[model samples]
Target chain A: MVSVGQHENIEILSHSEVEEVAGFVGNFKIKVRRKARYVTEDLCTGCGLCQEKCPAKKILSEFDAGLGTRTAIYLPFAQAIPRIPVIDRDNCRYFEEGKCGICAKLCPRGAVDFEQEDEFVELEVGTILVTTGFDLFDCSRVSQYGYGTYDNVLSSLQLERLLDASGPTRGKIVTRDGREPESIAIVHCVGSRDKNYNRHCSRVCCMYSLKLAHLIKDATNAEVYEFYIDMRTGGKGYEEFYERLQEEGVIFVRGRPAEVVPHDGRLVVKAEDANLGRLLQVPVDMVILSAGLEPRRGAQDVAHVFGLSRSADGFFLERHPKLGPVETASNGVFIAGACQSPKDIPDTVAQAGAAAAAAMVMMDRGRVTLEPSVAQANVRLCSGCGECVVACPYSALQLVEGHVEVDETLCKGCGVCVGHCRSKAITLLHFTDEQLLAEMQGALRVLEVA
Target chain B: MPEPKIVAYACTYCSYPGADLAGTLRIQYSPHVNIIRVLCSGRVSPELILRTFREGADGVLVLGCHYGDCHFVSGNHRTVKRVAVLRRILEYAGIEPERLRLEWVSASEGERFARIVDEFTETIRGLTPIEQVLA
Candidate 1:
């Protein structure tokens, strides 16, 4: 991603958003809001001088999942592209206490700028690809896990940074009190597949939890335990990795943990051993909750920007499940990665390539075929009582000059208007009354024969 | 005695797949149901439902997706209101409103679909047959 952002052809617009999107498949006009970074983009060379001189350094680092501290004028992470640190005006002392200009005073190339404001820009494009990604299901909602209350119990992302070499503890697996854990317990599916939280199994959690188990056990040599309802490692070398972790003497408890409680001066993980038909409480120094993923926050707003629809699961719905995985219901717009569903990195990358290809095909062809099954209003037979207008779910119908009109682009041809029309004036283009009657007859034919 | 005849109008996106899932899961229910799949529950008009009853169907079951989970956005809202009015019309026509039932079943709810069919079938069996009532 850093390499791509640095490419001469690719103009990476960080800290920007799509404010409005207009036009159809082949041609589109986009309005964008480029948020102020409080630092001028062109004048600044990627330098660490401003960061070293900043006085305010206690704000939580969002990139570290809030597990680490960063200076007010700091880059998002060590590996962030463009390497330019944005002055966080909200937390910067110069903006708040008004007593600091150390970054401006100390900069060698005079790159720090504090007087910038947000700007808007518009662009015209042929196609769009949406890959806004996903948000982790907040483990704090499942209060029974005691994620917020218990200091040792951390979310999976928090644990990822905790285990990273560049992280707070410098890659050491230790308790919050700077002591190595004698024992650890990793709980799986804290929010996914529980029916009360999320119905679908977050496909990546099982494998990652197993991977974490391996990493923690190897790093600290702690007696690690994994409490899971099931072990689903359905990927290349994933099942083998699970087997290796098991062979490495990690205790795999076959059940979901009921609760995490403070007991005997340590956190005790309480769960049922379903295979053994017994309840067990395993005391551990630390706990890691393998949380699941949901659609990114503001997913609905993003969908509205691109004229897309979301499925019951709240992920962006595709045009077709198998045949058009990358294509959205809206022509020329495509969706990829975790924004579409909870998938791992490989699946996300593969889908991204497919989405890019889908966009390319539409652009190259310069024309595309839409489904002919659109709603049509018969003006001659129309009473224009506006019943169909009221019943249309898409708002594609309207009373125009005492007759109903259909916006062919917006109508999905669901036939709700046809059913509600008092005059029998509205008809779905392909799925007409005659077609439905034929389908009904065909369905009942077997019963008649029997 | 002849088995009670039922005409079921199921939304193609949710309830129809739910019925197919019931078969896939081997969840047995009454086989007297004649399934007719439509694009949306809102497309199942009172006229079609009434015509089924007039054609000697013992009961009419209109199944759709859940309230907020409608495939056509707010299509099921219209279905809920339409079915309520249809039930009143049946009652005023000297026919039992229990003969016409409206349910919400999703694609993943195979057991719920089977259970709903079994319960609706049993309820219709308890009521006077539509053929006898017309005679």
Candidate 2:
């Protein structure tokens, strides 16, 4: 898809979902449901001509970090690959009461096709790579951050956009009241490194917070105060950057900002300077809470979908931490980005490249040699009890045509189903009863041989 | 009289190396023990332990890296929980749970490894034969 986008020939099938996955590692037949975009992709030139003509323009742009407004008929992002616009069906005029086709009337390419129906596509791929990424911790759950209650207190991601050149304020670091103040306090470890929330140090926030401080300093000329319990700048060039930031006269408070109270139209941060052993209240114009990374909302659902395992931290479990960092316990599936753990941009990109390489390696192999220890149903002895089907961890066993069939590719050779089969219907190929008995006898035969 | 058949499932990272250390150090513990090296104690399935007993082994010993010292970072945690649950299952099935044991041994703990094996073998020697329990 990235290659196609580079060539500008990308036909993005947006609003699509994989309904089912059937077949093996190298021979997967994935059934995908491409929901109606309500606008034709092949014909849509994404000229922004239709969006200007359409009256519905009040929808919140989820892509713009929800800080800016977007039209109902709009492109998701500037570099949005197919350059096609999707109609917000709920808010669209024609969808509501057949009142508006202004988008259809104004589109130069005649791209607006209201009668388009949902499509089902089956793709054949040698391998599958999952890089669903991660979601930011919602600060509202913590409640102490005053995110929704106070307008000035913003999440780290929100601050990223707010401080970004392409942001709502056009790169100006200012509060919602439109005043750039003299003092700004950045709180570290908002949702992470706390047992109450995520216990893991988010690994990236420290560096990004430094970046934000530099950017904010350059933009606002404000006296920036970074309150952190522990300054974690362990990555490459990170500690040096932190040192440089210190040399540049940024206040490095060895403490965590406990509370943000609204006082005199400014946010007053109450925190303890652990080194100084005294309470300090710093009044600031804006507060950027360095929120942590969290598991994606449907992480467990995706785990179930792929029959993968998750660690206690809810990140996808790698087959082996050192040996197979990118690979899952289930074969053919790989994980990258914060889906595995909290990582900085360099680490995330490295993992992404590794995951891509791993996927490419599998693809290059053409066909994966499945473990011979997969469970096989002995149809003659099969009672159709369906006990083994439930016992199989990988969902390798399924009742087909009133008989149990083993999906060789999906099985991990755990042999749980072999034990569950009351009628002795299922047998793991390499670890079959006969083979195991022979191995046992061989081990015992050593005594006689000696 | 037959020697007591002992199956030792040693985690590759620590306990397996510890056994090798014991051998290098010439620590005479027990010739009855037959070591089976696994990736981690987490990789030692309950079925493998049960299968060892079914194969006429008098005792099964699962050794892993010490708690918080697992090479795979908490693979032994799952091992601990699994072995704990498996012990209950063994007791329920009329087998003495003492027949199966899980312990943490580091790569440097050669003397500790010898001690563990000696102690566990002595405990198994005091118990009835696994065949008698099964019968």
Candidate 3:
């Protein structure tokens, strides 16, 4: 990211969103809306004075996943690209009560700009790639886990921040009462692989939970128990890591916990160990829910803007799962990372490279060929009934002037409109009624011989 | 009706592959299941299903990807909605709605594909033949 920021040919527009996209493949004009940072990115030398002396320190740190507090005017995190700080306009006293401007006064570079408006940036591009990433499933939604209710119960992200060297506790595994825990329960599959929640298995949680168990044991030597339905260690060298954790005395319970309750000042986890066929209520000082990953918030809006489709699982759908994993239904658009599915770092990076390569290939080819088997509308036979328009999934058909028109680029030749057309005005190039009927007859004939 | 012909529309991505897997695994199922591969179950319109029924097929089974696994994003969504409305239309037209059934079978679910085929065939066998019902 630093190299990309420093590169002469590359431009990084931070705190921005793609507001509008127009045009087709190899000729897209994107309108990006850059949010007002309230601080000059160029002038602000990432010197850490404004963050330290700022009076508004009660605001929760987003980077810490709400486990730590930060001042109103601060960067997202220490290692954020460009290392520029953004003012919290809502919590900033200068904006609210018009009183405190301590960060503006203490800044050495005088880079604060209160009057900065959101700037719109327009870019013309050949191809587009979407890597919007994912959001961790809200653990509190799984009421049985007692995530938000129990003080000692934490999300995996919170434990991650706690395990960080520069975190609030300086890598200490302590309960809310400021005492080191003797026993900790790691609950896996929270909001994953359940009919009530997400039915898909979150692919990366098992390995990361093992890593966390290793980290916690190494730091606190606490008795760690992992409750999981299945330990999916399918990736390279992942099973070995699981074995190593097992050797380190981290207990593995093969069951999804039924519930977590606060009992006698400690959290009691009730689960039926599948292997033992016995129910166990283990009391622990702290509980960490290995939450699942879901599609990023507002991914649907992004999908709509990019002319992409999201699968029923809420992730961006690919063109073909086996052949074209990164390409979307849209010609010039591609998808990668957790936005597509819950993948690990390696898989996400691999998909990102594939998506980038797909875009580059489109750019190199210069032009794309429209499929010959596209739908066509006969204007003369049109009855002005818009049944075909509504039946077309791609929104390629439109009733213009009492006649249906087909956008060749948008149509996949699915033949849906042809079936819906009462007047038989619309017909797909290859998949006509006669052709489909012949195919169906050929398929049904084999049973007649018996 | 001799064998009660059943026409099944199997999606190429999911159900067709599942059928192929069942063949490879030598999973025995009813021979009455006449599978016709389509790009998606969504591509099988109500007209095609009605035509199949008119052609003396006792039952029409539509199978595609499980929910959330559609290769065309939400192609099965269209299938679900189409079949649901078609079922209601069939009921209103005095034909048994059980003649048409929709099932989801993924590529990895070979056993499920075989079971679905067997179950649909049985359901069709239990019903009055389409020829007599519409006569």
Candidate with best TM-score: 1
What TM-score, over all chains together, does every model reach? 0.78, 0.73, 0.75
The DockQ of each candidate is: 0.35, 0.08, 0.22
List the lowest-lDDT window of 10 residues for candidate 2 chain A. Answer: A441-450
Model 2 reaches what TM-score against the true structure?
Answer: 0.73
> Candidate 1 vs. truth: CA RMSD?
4.7
Clashing pairs in 1: none
CAPRI quality of model 3 = incorrect
Task: Give lDDT tens digits, candidate 2, residues B15-104.
Answer: 887898799899999777777766567656667678888878888899987776565444576667778898999999998899899998
In order, the candidates keep a fraction of the true contacts of: 0.40, 0.01, 0.18
What is the number of backbone collisions in each predicted candidate, taken in the order shown? 0, 0, 0
Question: Candidate 2's residue-wise lDDT over A309-389, tens digit each?
Answer: 566577776766789999875567788888888887789889999998998888887777765656788898998888767
lDDT-sorted candidate list, best first: 3, 1, 2
Q: Which ten residues in a row have the lowest lDDT in candidate 2 chain B?
A: B68-77
- What does the lDDT read for residue B45 in candidate 1? 73
Supply the global lDDT for candidate 2: 0.79
Rank candidates by DockQ, best first. 1, 3, 2
**What stretches of model 3 exceed 4 Å from their correct place?**
A19-23, A29-31, A40-50, A94-122, A193-195, A227-230, A251-284, A303-313, A376-411, A416-426, A443-450, B1-135
C-alpha lDDT (0 to 100) for residue A427 of candidate 1: 81
